[model samples]
Target: MADGEEVTLDGRPLHLLRVADLKAALESRGLAKSGQKSALVKRLRGALMLENLQKHSTPHATFQPNSQIGEEMSQNSFIKQYLEKQQELLQQRLEREAREAAELEGAFGAKSGDFGNLSHLEGIWVKFRRIWVI
Candidate 1:
């Protein structure tokens, strides 16, 4: 299969891998397998892509110069496509991470005057504070 190409099971995509098989693969890779099919597919794809990246290094030296314009063009196009896919994947990952970070910040961000145990009394406390206590 070409680089970045997804693996298929039973003519369907990798997501079609049965739950048992997917769990086995995840456990073998030391990953948590407690999610749904979509999550499993995502984890497996990321693991597979990471493995593929580790296996393949720079492809520049692998190309054999061909005198035919068509052959050279095809190889160049393939390389360009592969690089573009990798770039797209990286961009997507960056966006996902940024979104998660923003969510985490939103979850943990509390204003300075926010109360923890007496949250329900926040506005009441502000309204009933001593009038002369500056």
Candidate 2:
């Protein structure tokens, strides 16, 4: 089929599709792609028909309060809340780490330190080594 053309499950457009195009469409819909052109066409048609039926079908199941489903919904809500709390804790930890890093940088006089000077780096390394070694 041509690009930008509306794909129809109708017999004409489906029949016009090349084997490769048919296989591609089948593969896209997670349908079995290993088949002859005619078989592929039939499979695609069935899938499209089923999909159309599902879209048109009305809901058979209705939500009932104070049921097992309600308990499941509450459990899902609890999980969501727990995940949000974990995310908040993670954010706080990241902020703490950033603050500590900034304090370390300040102690090293990083903003004003002469990074181009080898002697300055050597002095900082010596201080770092002394603190760690002790």
Best by TM-score: 2
The collision pairs in model 2 are none
In model 1, how large is the Cα lDDT of residue 70? 45
Q: What is the lDDT of residue 82 in candidate 1?
A: 65
RMSD of each: 23.5, 15.7
Deviation from truth (RMSD, Å), model 2 = 15.7
- Candidate 1, residues 1-134, lDDT tens digits: the string is 57677765445677778988888888999999988988998888788767777788666765657646545544686765765565556556656655655566579895433433343333434443322112
Badly placed stretches (over 4 Å) of model 2 are 1-7, 10-12, 63-134
Q: Which pairs of residues clash in candidate 1, taking residues 3 or more apart in a chain or in different chains?
A: none
- Report the C-alpha lDDT of model 2 over 1-134, residue by residue, as the tens digit: 33475346544577788888888889989989987888988888778767876988887588655567535644686765765565556556656655665686789867534334544544655564443331
lDDT of 1: 0.65
Error of 1 at 134 (Å): 63
